[model samples]
Target: MPEAPPLATEHLTRVVDGQTLVADVSIEVRAEEVFVVFGPSGSGKSSLLRLLNRLDEPTGGTVYLDGTDYRTIDPRTLRRRVGWVPQRPTLIEGTVAENVAWGPTLRDEPVDEARLHELLDRLGLSGFADRDADRLSGGEAQRVAIARTLFNDPDVVLLDEPASSLDAAAADRVESLLADVMAAYALTAVLVTHDADRARRLGHRGVRLHDGGGVATGSLDALLSG
Candidate 1:
């Protein structure tokens, strides 16, 4: 039998502002696999991603990470174990290196310069270490955000529209970078995206959301073009 996936959600549900945002969602994300949540605006894609990493608690049901219930895990520890890259990259006023090192620093882990350099190179920010993170372009900053998330060496990465802010060319670059990073790190990834074509190009199974609930589960092509 195949090995179990790295992350799973069972009967997950969430409600906000007196309305349901996600309901009865269950899915598995395997190691080194890119699992994408696709939907239109306000369809609860981001909320679902947040639930996986425990950034948002479910109104009902549970999230499992590596076979453990996420809610039972300490928030700080769970967050460190599961990295998150938000839709809009928020950069602290600091050198790129400082921003990337922030996660490890918080965990009291000695900075791994080699790993830091490697991630920067892998994410195409090779010469950006000393540059101000606040000075980067949207695409560049998004890449830096990814690098920062990987710096902690988490088992899973949650990406909420990592490429949504980029132009067509830059978005393409972000997608390629994400694929490479996931493979190289053997990390489980859950991404929230609105672009159907980008979701197809990522070549991952997709979970579709509509009307604040999971509508279907299938290949990106089947779900998006259907």
Candidate 2:
């Protein structure tokens, strides 16, 4: 039998004040696969990513991680296993290594230097351990942010348009970096994006979040044609 997917959602809904940002949306993300969430602006793509990560509470429905209800787990523990990379990453005042080691070190877990080098090399940031994070380009900063999140050793990564703010060259770099990172870690990822082409290119499956309580999900081809 096939292994159960790493993540799935059932009728997830989120409402802020009187506004319902995300309607009932459901999806199943296979283990080590990239699941893309595509939508036009104001379609709640960001909202859905937040709900999946439990960064924002849902008004209704449930989230499952490895067939276990996520709500049953403590929020902090859940977050460590499910890291988030935002549209605009925030870099602390420190060297790249310091930012990457912050999480595990904070948790009192010894940072793995070899593994750190491996990840930095993979992200094209090798020998940049001592580089000031504040001076990195948009793409470089995002890569550092991703490497930092990886220090937490998350099984699933949530990306809310990590490449959206970058220029074409930088965006391509970030996109390639994401693909490499996922492959290296065999991670399951949910990426929210306004670029349908990106969704088709990187996602194993894709979903389009409509304005109301409607969602259209299917293979990448279907998403591109919609």
Worst 10 residues of 2 by lDDT: 206-215
**Residue 137 in candidate 1, Cα distance off native in Å:** 1.1
**lDDT for residue 159 in candidate 1, whole number 0-100:** 88
Q: Superposing all C-alpha atoms, what RMSD in Å does each candidate have to the true structure? A: 1.6, 1.4
**Candidate 2, which segments miss by more than 4 Å at Cα?**
1-3, 212-214
| TM-score (C-alpha) between model 2 and the true structure | 0.96
- Give the TM-scores of the predictions, in the order they appear: 0.94, 0.96
The digit string of per-residue lDDT tens for model 2 on 55-163 reads 8999999899888999999998999988999999898888999999989877888889999989999998999999999889889999999898887889789989999
- Candidate 1: which pairs clash? none
Clashing pairs in 2: none
Best by TM-score: 2
